[model samples]
Target: MKLEIVRSCIFGFLLVIVQYSLAQEKPNIILLYADDISARELPIYGSTVWSLPKGGDTSDRQYRAQTPVLDHLAEEGIYVKTAWAATICSPSRAMMMTGRYAHQHKWWHNSDKGKAPNKKGSWNLYDSAPYTLEDIAHKGGYATYWAGKTQMKISGFNFDEACFTPGEGSYNTPIATTDFRLETRKINGQKKIFNADTNQEATSYVQSGWYWKPHVQLLNHPKATGPLEWWPNNKAAKDTFGLNTFGPDVELEFIFDFMERKQQEKKPFFVYHTSHLGHDAMDFLNPESKSKWPGTPKISWDGKTYTRIQPNVTGDNGVYDTHGTITESGIHHHINYLDYQVWRYMNKLKEMGIANNTIFIFCADNGTSGYGKGSPVSQKGTHVPLIIYAPGMNMTKKGLQDILVNMSDMLPTIAEIASVKIPDSYEVNGESLLPFLTTDKPKHREWIYGYHKDMQIIRGDFVLKDGKNDWWDVSENPDDLISFKKIKDWRAVSEAHRKERDELNKVLPRFNLHATAHDAPKNGLEKPTPLQLIEDNK
Candidate 1:
């Protein structure tokens, strides 16, 4: 009896050891998604044109973004030559979260969306897709955390924890604590943006500040008093809440804290950081500046350390002094700061001794606001940078990969990484990139697709059909990253171009919902249905 008991105890101990080893093998994944940045904005893509420090037409002034850290990541890992998303933010995010296009999720554009069948509002992505990326991570035995921007409806968020996440309060009420913000109020019968500091009409930017003294909210935080609440509720955050408190910096701090806690618990994590950095916003610190995007706090990187200069700004009622602490306003400054943030992420992972066991991905939603956000011509609106690095895995692809990819691929790629098999009932348009990245796969995809409202955009290796139904020869590189040669006649093109065009032509019909009209109910479609909308011209 004693010998039999000892064998049972030894078997249990071995089982536990095996389970622990399997758990340790699962890597930590961080999805670093930037907002409103085009592929050309990154120095790695080799675009000759970039936005100036101030603001102007892309053709007027030239200023390239400084992204040494991103450049290095792309060099060491793999950067997609062409990656597409929607022409704007909402649809792009829906695509990334669901691994489906506008047709499947019913998020055709920013303003246009499918109506809910049972409710009197727009249908959310959660309603359409079987499960979200967060759900998949959970199924794969991972804790999920979301930081930075939350462009989607807050109620639909399924992540375990969130920090500096925008919420209902962001739009409903003014954060009464800080003086740096712009609010819209009913002035007589018309809604007008009022300068919170001055309580007067301000021309600079008439929206809540997301840069300096940003309006932040927290979810499931240890210090939080409720499930979801406004930040600065805690003593530490309240004390640090001032004119100098940068939102992005606070986001990183919370992420680092979460990583440390998860590490102690021996849990794999998935961090989806939707950084607001590439997007253009009003310059609140230097209100007089004509730049579209506001500047960030000055930061200097000396190879080993990054020293950020504390912002010293004092003012109210439309007048302020920055004390030469803020960098000049421009998209370039935002990109530079993002590079610094990337460095911080790497440093934290290294500190936790999880650097090699982490899968890092960087991409953006849509294109630059002024240059390409709404434009569906060529690849301007849809094209964005895609860089992936999985140091722990034996990824075969390195440096620039001349393949076509899209935002929809992110969900399935992450799902595969988490080792979660998507249910067969759900249809995901994106193909998982895990096998291609890890194995000796020669190509990722034959073509990529995108949309702008009802317009259908599809592209192959040699041919591209734009939103306007115009064809272009995209085989060769052009001086301007987007300007491909217009193909007047299919008969005149080479057999290779014709063959690829035929293949892309066949691919579009499968996704076409006859979406020329975007009214949901008019098309007799319910929530999550595959039917397309038809406009009411009456």
Candidate 2:
């Protein structure tokens, strides 16, 4: 009997060891972040604005984009019903990258410099808190790769491998050396192309062509070719496949290649694909007299797959010989194309046999460009789409979760997965969402917070404290801002509503205490950073 007991104890110990080993194994994370897309734009999230016509056809132009790839992925995974992002691109990205809010990070607004009196001059938010997903993953023995659009610049964020365009240049940047750098402006009356590089500083704007002849720069790669300096070794490929080169296509190709290479080397990789889609800038819409939408290498989706036909663009530097794309303008087409790219990623993973081990997250920075990017009144400016698909984690459930998920939650989740120890001294405004990936459903945040410049918004279960200093009933919302109910007194609402409101009100002081931290006085109130009180046990 004693001998049998010893054997059973040994077996149990071995089982525990195996379980710990499996838990420690890191999974590859791929964050496919779209530009200027909102929760309302996705049909899965339910948007009547871009809903399909009664006949369910595309000719009417009102037909919503069919994102079967994302739709199916959401159906097979978990999606957050109430996901919060910052009002604009820079702050939203800062939250995601740093796992902290604007108050701590000091990225209160869009520009690179902080406008607050406490944090003044060219003091960028990222330099102070230099920790990012890249830093965490790199330290945790994982390769990190970032691609597509980077709207903001964060200091000390050096990824292991990256192919990305800096700030708003993804539209008309040249893709290859053979591609033209668009120097030819309208000389008197006629449009002309200066094939050679010119010394015109005015014509050379930071906003270069990112799509056709994409202006790109290489980082940590030897004998690499792209924006800054054209390498001699890449001249052959540039001449051959240069003219019809496309930006999105180039980024996607690099991502797939990175995945395959990682798989071959038996290494884990964290990929951040920040796509420049769902945004139709007026400048991009009418680059010239012709429609650039229906131009060049056209991407087609036949309900199942995507096919691209590279156009023979024969012209001088920036002037593409091709007129426009076959596809029309609007956010729908851009979203549809984004879906196709998602399909391509799924297939690439399957081919590499890493689909089972990969974790895919699809989200957008903010709402659509025109309607919601900088909207002040409601939570419309901050809400975004969030879908998580991780098969290796063995998640069986699909559909929406009502947990209050903040954009800052991304970093902690990644850090937890990488087995990196987030410092105990540092306080972040986010908690890990990894528990939800498993069958365990732990308690989440009671309220989420967002800051844009001096304006602050706090979201609760039934109430949304807007930047306008007004309280809103956001329950049962496809959020209509028409009805603005004023908070007269405690007797204005029912006991349950009052109870909820009181609970939410208790948290407001914590945020208000920091009102004086702004560089400039906001609404004439001096906001100071809140002091964190830690109680010690007797």
Candidate 3:
């Protein structure tokens, strides 16, 4: 009996030690999401769709535009060529944060009024029509911070800190008003900014609009208040310097600051820094030279007229300016700006002595503007860039990976990297990419699907469209620009995808019900909150 008791005690002690060790071994995650960036724009990806201006040459390889930072990251990390996201911002973000498809989130469109609702006739941030990754992180005891563009309406779940900069309606002018600076507030005698700032308030200066300097808001979180509160303009607030400060530069500064503070506390954290850099914005400083590109507008978003520049291309008609194309030089500059921001982020990590300990993930929400976003093109609007960097990882060169991955996969990937187990009750549509990252083995999905109004399925080289049941051999013509030889029968293809669609449909209940739930009240039934609906489904 004595011997048995001793053995039992030893086992119990060992169990406690192991549990404690695991609880302490969380990895820090930094997600850098660029806006409106297309796979075709990156020279590293072998595309010459756009070129740099003559005087703006920054590298010896003229064919290859400047992107030293992204190149370095690609060399140090694993580059995934087959990653995808929803075409637009809100839908893409919803899919990413919830680890579900657009059909599940019920956020197919940007506007909230069109979709289904919670029991309350309106969707509340706390209600889980879409449970966010930040919420999962918070529940798992990780501190979460959101910085930069936030287009989603739902709030709460998990975000210790949040900040947002309003996107430009038009991509013209260097200085438009923006939510760009940092303000400090006292929390328990320690100075801290509001965890999140929605850049809804208009600013006086155009540079402030650049998302880099002049105007910025700060908020404070005493505990985990559901609603974000901004710090008043008080003496305690201090303005961030904005001498030619770019938006990405301002964002990285705060990110580094947060990481260093967390490092000192020895606490693992998750930072989501969304960049508005690559998105089209007019450079007011350097007006397009008319001599090089005939009929090109000199100013982007000309404030004098409150319109975008008219491009020289046919069908442009100068009717509406979405920032006219000025020799494609503006696109190059925007990409270079994005590259500089990436360099800053990596350098900051190294500077703070947390380079190796941090797991850096870089991705975009959806495909590029012209080819993808808001369209069901052959390439699909979902395609985007995905890169992962871990100093501990043995990867040291740029590699092309054809493995199927999606925005929904990020939550699971992060969970694995942080060594946390995802709860089974929480429905997730992604598999961890940790396997591919750790092992060089090729990975492929049986079928990858993209959803908007039309659902697209990728099985081998064949793509099946959902509603129309249209079948197209996307493998032969990935761009979907080829003329059809005959009127193809879509029913056969749709039937072929029936089993996979059925599985995807099962995941749809939670989101579809949430979106349409607002109408349940008219049926004499009390509507459940989005969270309640999700919980009921579970």
Best by lDDT: 1
Ranking by lDDT: 1, 2, 3
lDDT per residue, candidate 3, 298-371, as tens digits? 23222222122333322211222324443244445556556656666676777777777677888887655544
Provide the overall lDDT of each model, using Cα atoms, as 2-decimal numbers: 0.79, 0.64, 0.52
Candidate 1: tens digits of C-alpha lDDT, residues 180-233: 667777988998877776676766444566788877788898877898888778
Would you estimate the TM-scores of all the predictions?
A: 0.90, 0.78, 0.66
Task: Rank the models by TM-score, top first.
Answer: 1, 2, 3
Query: How much does each candidate deviate from the true structure in C-alpha RMSD?
Result: 9.3, 8.5, 12.9
Judge candidate 2 against the unseen true structure and give its global Cα lDDT, from 0 to 1. Answer: 0.64
Candidate 3 matches the true fold with a TM-score of: 0.66
Error of 1 at 263 (Å): 0.7
Q: After superposition, how far is residue 37 of candidate 2 from its true place, in Å?
A: 0.6
- Give the poorly placed runs of model 2, Cα more than 4 Å off: 1-25, 51-63, 115-121, 166-206, 222-233, 240-243, 282-297, 312-325, 479-492, 512-515, 519-538
Clashes of each: 1, 30, 24
> In model 3, which regions exceed 4 Å deviation?
1-24, 50-65, 112-126, 129-131, 167-215, 221-245, 281-329, 394-398, 439-441, 454-470, 476-538
